[model samples]
Target: MTPSSSSEKSFNDWYEDEHIPLLSGVPGWLDSGRYRLTISTTSHAPSYVALHRWTDLAAFDTAEYKTATNTAWRTTVMEKVVKKERFLLQYKGELCNILDTLL
Candidate 1:
């Protein structure tokens, strides 16, 4: 997500204080983290990214999830976002563990 320069602070505050906490309460939501882009190969890359892990896709369809996403603060913050992207990825299998081999 790329928030407008004018709304950067508001976006950070709302996302960290409100959004993450709310989503964390939803069942099957395992963990979440937010990161700022320090380096990127493409200029079009967003300034920020958030990753969320869930036990299953069904967690997203729950009433709690909807309530967390549909909020006044979210609406306000989103208006300031110039670019955003979302993806739901499924875990396949771990390819290799270097640490295991080393041990």
Candidate 2:
């Protein structure tokens, strides 16, 4: 997600101090991390990315997850996001094992 320049600090603060902590308390939420895009080739790429891991897709349907996402601070911060995207990917087997089988 990319926040407008004026809202960058607020976005960062909300994400770090509030959002992550709240989500971390949810059941089946394994871990999460945030990253900045430093070398994207696309001109309009979002400035930030957040990766979250869960035990299963059911975690997203939980009350805790819903509560964590529906906060006033998240609403305010999200309003300033110019672009955002979300994807849920299932984990395949290890890369090394796959590569060895191919070789």
Candidate 3:
């Protein structure tokens, strides 16, 4: 997530304080986290990343989650951001080992 400098404060506040909490109540949403990249070769690369965990794809099929995300505030935040990326991923085997190797 790379928010415009002007909207950075608003984006962070809405995402951390409101948006994430709202999404948590949706069915099959396991958890979520936000992070910033410590190292990057390109200065224009995304500075932040948000990881949202779900039980399965069925989680995203729910109307509740869809409705929650399709709000005015969400739209406003998205429009203000410069760049962002979303990934839907599943947990494979032995993530702890992979993390150890990478770190």
Candidate 4:
């Protein structure tokens, strides 16, 4: 999701306040963390990347993923303000250093 810095940080902070300790309570989900990537000033607009990592495939397939979701404000914001979508696909080969964890 593309979010302005202020909105992005606000959403993340709100989510952390709402989730955090709660996410660890959700079964099958472990080591959940949020990460932000630096923006490229050369681009037309400043941007940031948000990363959410689940323990493993099973963690993602489990009930936690279904029952635990975005906070109300975030949900409303996405529903009202954000109007873009992308489908994620799992493929061979590492997309980035994310695999470094396993290595």
Cα error, candidate 3, residue 68 (Å): 1.8
Task: TM-score each candidate.
Answer: 0.88, 0.86, 0.81, 0.49
Q: What clash pairs does model 4 have?
A: none
How much lDDT does each candidate structure score? 0.93, 0.92, 0.84, 0.53
Candidate No. with top lDDT = 1
In the predicted model 1, the residue pairs found to clash are none
* Clashing residue pairs found in predicted model 2: none
Candidate 4, residue 42: lDDT:
60
Ranking by lDDT: 1, 2, 3, 4
Residues 31-75 of candidate 4: C-alpha lDDT, one tens digit per residue: 644544465656543243334455455655666554556557657
lDDT of 1 by residue, 18-89 (tens): 999999999999999889999989989999999999988899899999999999999999999999898879
Better model by TM-score: candidate 2 vs candidate 3:
2
Model 2 stretches astray by more than 4 angstroms = 92-103
Measured on C-alpha atoms, candidate 3 has an lDDT of 0.84
Worst 10 residues of 1 by lDDT: 87-96
Candidate 1 positional error at 71, Å: 0.3
| Tens-place lDDT digits, model 2, residues 14-36 | 99999999999999999999999
Order of candidate numbers by TM-score, starting with the best: 1, 2, 3, 4
